[model samples]
Target: MKQKTIGLLGGCSNVATAEYYRFLNEAVNTRLGGWEIAETLIAGMNFGNIEAFVRTGDWDGLGRYMKTKIDGLVAGGADVILCVSNTLHKPLEDLMDRGGVPMIHIADPTGVAMSAAGLSKVAIFGTKPVMEMSYLKDQFQHRFEVQAIAPTEEEQCDIDQIIFDELVKNKLKDTSKARYLEIADRMRREEDAEGLILGCTEIFLLIDQDDRPDFPMFNTARLHCEAAVDFALS
Candidate 1:
C-alpha cells in the first residue's frame, strides 16, 4: 500500500499548527523507528482573513475560502485532511463532504476517550465558538452520549481573551496559567465535571495532565495526531 499524505489546514493560529506538525513526525518515528516521518502537506491561511470571516459571522465566505485552501492540498497529493484548530472545523464542515479525502475531526478521538473512561459530563475550555457554540459540544453528545459543560458567559470571555491575546501570539504567562487552573478547579468542585477537554489546540501550552494530576484532561491535539498517524500507517 502507498503511504497516504496527511493534509493539515492550519493557521487559525500558527502556534497550534506547529504542535500538530511536531506531534505527527514524532509519533511516526516512534512507531516505525529510525528517522522516518509521515508524508504531510500543509495549507496554512492568514489568520487575519480567517478571524475576519468568523467575527463577521460570515461562515459561508469562510467555507468558500477554506474549500479553496483544501482544494490546493488535494491537488498537492494530500490523501487525508486534518484541520488543526477546533474552531476551523465549523467552516470546514462542507469542505469535508466535498473534498473527497478522509477528514479527521478534532473532536472524535476526544469523545472516544471520554466515553471509554465512562465520563457522562466534562468541562471544556476553548476559543469563544468552541465553548459558546454547539459544534464540539453537540458532537460529544450525539456521537458519544457525553454531555459538555462550558464556563459561564463571563468566564467564557476571560478564556477567549486569554486564547487570542496570549496563546495565539505564542506568549505564555504564569498569571494566565494560574487563572486557567483556578477556573478549572472551580468547575470541578462545583459542576461535578468528570474530566476536562482541552478543546483549543494551543491549550496544551498553557496546561496539561501534569498541571492537575488528580484530574483527567483530554488533549484533543495529541489524540487527533495519534489518529492521523494510525490512518497514515494503516
Candidate 2:
C-alpha cells in the first residue's frame, strides 16, 4: 500500500499548526522506529480571513473558502483530511459535506482518549463557541459517560485573553500560566472534574503537566495526532 498523506487544515495561528505538525511527525517517527515521518499535506490559510469567517459565523463563506483548500489537498494527493483548529471545525463540517473527502473528526479521537482514561467528568477549556456549543459535549457524552465542565465567567474571560492575546500571538506569559493552573485547581475542587481536557490546540502553549499535577491533562493535539498516526498506518 502507498504511504497515506494526511491533509492538515491549519492557520488558526502558526503555533497550533506547528504543534500539530510536530506531534504527528514525532508520533509517526517514534512508532515506526526510524527517521521516517508521516507523509502530510498542509495548507495554512490566512488567519485574518479565518477569524473573520468565524466571528461572523458565515458557514457559506467558510465552506467555500475551505472547499478551495480541500481541492488543493486532493490535487496534492491527500488521502484524508484533518482540521487542526477546534474552532475551525465549525466550518469544517460544512466543507467536508461538500468536498467529498474523508475528513477526520479531531474531537472524536479526544473522546476516545477520554473514554480510555475512564474519566466521568472532564473540564473542557476552549473558545466561547466550543464551550457553549453541544458539538464537543455531545461527542464525549455519546462515546463515553463524560460530562464536560467549563471555567467560571471570570475564568472564561481570562482564558479567552490568554489564548487570543498571549498563546495565539506566540507570547506565553507567566501570568497566563498561573491563571490556567488556578482554573484547573478550581475545576477539580468545585466541579469535581476528574481530569482536564485542553480542548483548544493552542492551550498546550500556555499550560501543561506542571500546572495540573493533581489531575491527568488530556492534550487534544496529541490525541488528534495519535489518531492520525493510527489511521495512516492502518
Q: Estimate each model's TM-score.
A: 0.97, 0.94
Best by lDDT: 1
Per residue, candidate 2 scores C-alpha lDDT tens digits across 141-202 of 88777899888888888887777777888898888888888888888998898998898898
Distance from true location, Cα of 132 in model 1, Å: 0.7
Model 1 segments beyond 4 Å from truth? Answer: none
Model 2 compared with the native: what TM-score? 0.94
Clashing pairs in 1: none
Model 2 pairs in collision: none
lDDT of 1 by residue, 65-88 (tens): 898889999999998899999988
Q: Candidate 1 at 186: error in angstroms?
A: 0.7
Candidate 1 yields a Cα-based lDDT of 0.91
> What is the TM-score of candidate 1?
0.97
